[model samples]
Target: MNVLEFLDSPELTPGTFEGDTWEPWRAVLSGAFGLPMDKGRARLFKRLSGGRKAPTSRVRELLVLAGRRSAKSNTSAAVAVYLATIGAEMDGLLDKLKPGERGVVGLIAVDRAQAKVLFRYIEGIFDASPVLSKLVSKRGAESIDLNNRVSLEVHTNSFKAVRGRTMIAALLDEACFYADENSASPDVELYRAIVPSLATTGGLLIAISSPWARKGLMYQKWKKHYGKNSDVLVVQGGTQDFNPTIDPRVIKEALEDDPEGARSEWLGQFREDISDFMRRDVVEQAARVEPLELPPCADTRYFGFADPAGGGKDEFTMAIGHRDGERVVVDVVRGRRGTPAQIVEEYAALFKDYRVSRITSDRFAGSWPADEFKKHGITCDQSAKPKSQLYVDSLARFNSGQVEIPPEDKLITQFCNLERRTARGGRDSVDHPSGGHDDRANAVAGLLAEAATRPANIIFECLDDGYEPEWHPYQMFS
Candidate 1:
């Protein structure tokens, strides 16, 4: 049976996917599979597909941009199940696999927890259908092997792991939110990795996600293909456009609270205020290949900065740096998860080793960091600038190759993930992405800013009566 017939048949999907709520998704699937559509659905197909005619053959790629609670995950799960079972056999996709090779249907999400949501939906559809349930030959935590040498798998976003697999279809859940420390553009890299695997089987690539910033692969595809004719089908709609059952009051309240976020969440619009703070290549250009941490040099006059945490979800991080001619070189960056007192003590010892008696830090915990550091014979002074301004000041140094940072993964990842947001007052603020931490990045930025802006220190040595005095310009002004 066709995908629409399978979804509508009560004996096939049972109590699941009832009513006209799934009509929008059915139209999407119809356009994707080159199936015939009614006049109304044809209009929707054109509207969503950028006013282009429906394809005469199945599209190789599809991009879905819809609002939250728009049934993207469920619809994707259904499509994956369909492609794995009946569609594979009917379309001769299984014949493309080599001998003893099993075809895969990969459902990849930003993380394991998100992948489970799609996996559970797939499990529910199979459990609800007698015909599809019988096709499940074996089921594992992250995979389900079917009887037809085709398997449905759940995977977290990883470009390396998805390579070399023969896939009939690959669904990217929440493609806009994919982030990786090792990659500058995780979504694009992952797409590149999955495409080669699908080339062997003539498989489908479907990316369904809500709009984020006006960047990333989702935005790029939307900008290029939306409302224009292209081989790749791009569909975008608001919450109600896809699922009308959601209450209007919820979205209304959200709009009242945060208009930009609400529009992105419920109206399917990309946020204009958020953008990347620094590019990965820019950060890499300032990073040294070897020596992740430098030992304290007696000849160097170091400046230290700390970002303190209360031993909770956040980490207490410290960074030490010194000025090298016109450039700032980060000597060391340390992060620890423990009680604030113990962390402060450890940082104080490290500071003393570098002969750094004074350090700058954010206004985190106020007088607590000052008091704690004072106990260990180190002076902690609150920075005159905020974290956002510190990042702003460091941006030029990073872009101009005036800073050298150690190749630390967490530190580099945090720096790469930082977002520069423009406020209504026309002021720009830099910060890490939501649900991400940037203690290491914050400390490094603070120290780098201090090292760059502060005047060079002058030291004079008194020699014999007639000898000329020598001056050293290496220390930072306390």
Candidate 2:
């Protein structure tokens, strides 16, 4: 039977989909598989199709960009399970698989937590039906072996991890927010890796995620393929468009807190407020294979910068670097979470060991960082310029290869996710993306800025008369 019919089975799967709760998904699925949708659902499908016409033929690829808690994971899991169990029985699907070859299905997530959610959904669906359960030859912690020779695997979001697999179908959950480390862009790397593998098996690829930045594979596809009536179906909708159960009051509350973030998270709209500030190629070119843990060299004058969090949700981070000709080589990066007094004591000792008597900070908790550092006979100076200026100078250094950073994942991620927000008067500001922290990036940038401003390393100095600066770098939106 078709997937819609299977899900709508009254006796066997009655409560699987409540009345109209899954109608939008069912409509999309019916269009994808060339099944018939009721007139009401057909109209609903057209209105929410994001400009693509339903194909008379089968859909080989699909991209769904919807808001969070919109039941995207459940829909993706359902599709994955259906393809695993029923693809072999379908004429065109598993017929492409090589003889005696088990078709591989992948459910990939940005992290373990998301992977677990998808894994459990598939597991629960299989467990609900005895008929479907009989198809499992083996069940694993994050995978299942179907008697039909289809191997289902759950994976963290890494293209390298999924390379060389013969896939029947792959679902990329929350693909837009796939954090990047080594690669310039995780979504692009994953797409480049999985798309070629699927060609061999003539398999299906489905990427579903809430709209994030205007970059990455999801955004690129949305711009290029969406509403073009092509083989790849790209659909965009708000949370309520697909899942009507989401309360409007909850969305209102989110919008009240952060309009830009809320729009992308619940309104299913790509954010215009954020874009990548630093180029990935430049950042990657400067990263060392390992972070330097060496002590201060006798001849090298070290500079230190700290982003203290005082045992809060954010990290307390410090970066130390020294000048070498025109280039600044980051020597050490230390980060931890602890009580304010403890963190201050530990970092003070480290700074002293590096021969750093005075350090730069962002003025944490109004004199606490300075007062605490004073206890250890260390001077903490509030940064003269804004953090935004530090980032701007750091970007300039990176573009010129004037700075070398350690190959730290946290630092790389923070740098890669940094956003350049521009205002109406053409004033530009830089900061981390929504739900992203830049403590390490901030420390590193601050250190680079500190090194560049040294009298020995000054490249250019500009003094303006009668110029009033009202905005600090830290007051981004303000």
Candidate 3:
């Protein structure tokens, strides 16, 4: 039976989907599978697809742009189940696999927790149907082995994990929000990896997510294919468009409070104020492949910066750098997760090793960072500029090829994931994306800005005593 027939059978998905609430999604799936639709659903299909005619044959790719609380995850689970069991058999996908090769149906999400939600839904759907339950030969935490050669698996947002797999189908839930510690564009990289796997099986690829910034793979696909008659079918709708059960008052209040955010969360529209801070190519150009960390030089003066955390989820990070001609060379960057006091003491010792007497940091814990560093004989000076300004200044350095960074994975990822947003007041701010950390990036930027802007020191020896005093030319005596 086809997916539409399975959804209509109460015995197959009993009490799982409401017909009225899921009508629009039903129309979407009908168009995706090239099934016939009624006049009403056909109109919705055309409207959502940018006035294009419904596909007469099954499309290889389907991109769904819908708002939050639109039941995207549940619908994705249902589609994955259908594709893994009946869809695979119908397309003879299992027969295409070589001997002893298992065909996989991958369910990918931004993180493991998010992926588990989709997995549980799939499990529940199978358990509700006695006929479908018999197909499960074995069950694991992240995978389900079917009696046929196909298996259902859960994955986080990483391209490496999906490589070398024989895939029958791949579903990317919340594809627009995919971020990784090692990749600037995790969704695009993961998509590139999955496409080849599906080539041998002539499988389906479905990506469903609420709209984000006008960037990344989801936005790009929507821009190129939403209203066109391309092989790839893209559809977009709001929360109420797909699920009318949601309260209108809630959406109204949300829109009143934050129009830009609410539009993306409730109206399925991309935000206009947000954009990427740095391009991947720019960040990669500043990184050196050899010498992950540089030792202190006897003749070079170093600048130190730290981003302190109170032994919580955030990491306490420190970066040491020095001037190399006109370039700001980051010598080393270290991050530790432990008691704040211990981390401060460890960083202080490292600072002294590099002959650094003073370090700069933002006023994170007020006088606490200063007091702690004093105990270790290191002077901690609060930076005059905020973290956002530091990032703004550092961007110029990156763009001008004046900053040299080590090939640190976390540092590169943090730099590439940073976002620059324009506020209502017409001010621009730079920082990491939501649910991301920038401890290392913050420290590096702070030190780079300091080193680049600091004036050169002039030293003079006292005539009477063999003592030398250093001073900046701009210094004035009272």
In TM-score terms, which candidate is top? Answer: 3
**Model 2, residue 323: C-alpha shift (Å):** 4.3
| Model 1 Cα shift for residue 222 (angstroms) | 1.5
Question: Cα lDDT of model 2 overall?
Answer: 0.80
Superposing all C-alpha atoms, what RMSD in Å does each candidate have to the true structure? 4.2, 7.9, 3.4
Off by over 4 Å in 3: 457-478
Clash number for candidate 2: 0
Q: Which is the better candidate, 1 or 3, if ranked by TM-score?
A: 3
> RMSD, model 1, all Cα superposed?
4.2
Across residues 1-478, which tens digit of lDDT does each residue of candidate 2 receive? 7878767765435477768788888887876776776779778777677656677766788888898888999888877887887754673667777788777899999888888998999988888887788888999899999988788899988898678778888999999888653455777888889988888877888999999879989998889887778778888889998888989999999998878878999999998877789887788888887645666654445778988785665788998888777788898887788787898999888887766778898754457889899998788898877888889888888999988888787787788778898654568899876445788899998898788676443232212321111222342110
Q: Which of candidates 2 and 3 is the stronger one according to TM-score? A: 3
TM-score of 2: 0.80
Give the worst 10-residue stretch by lDDT in candidate 2. Answer: 460-469
Instruction: For candidate 1, write residues 1-478 as lDDT tens digits.
Output: 8888878878777877888887888888898888999999889888766677787678888999999999899888988998998889878999998999999999998888888898999999999888889989999998999999999999999988789899999999989988775565789999999999999999999999999998889999889878766568899888988999999999999998888888889998899989999998999888899799889754556779999998786789999988767888898999989988988999998887777788988975588999999998888899998888989998998999999999988788889989988876678999877556788899999998788665544344523431233445554453
Off by over 4 Å in 1: 310-314, 336-345, 366-375, 460-478
What are the clashing pairs of model 1? 50-227
Alpha-carbon TM-score of each model against the true structure: 0.90, 0.80, 0.93
Candidate 2 off by > 4 Å: 37-40, 91-101, 249-257, 282-298, 308-317, 323-354, 365-389, 396-413, 421-429, 434-437, 457-478
Error of 1 at 374 (Å): 4.5
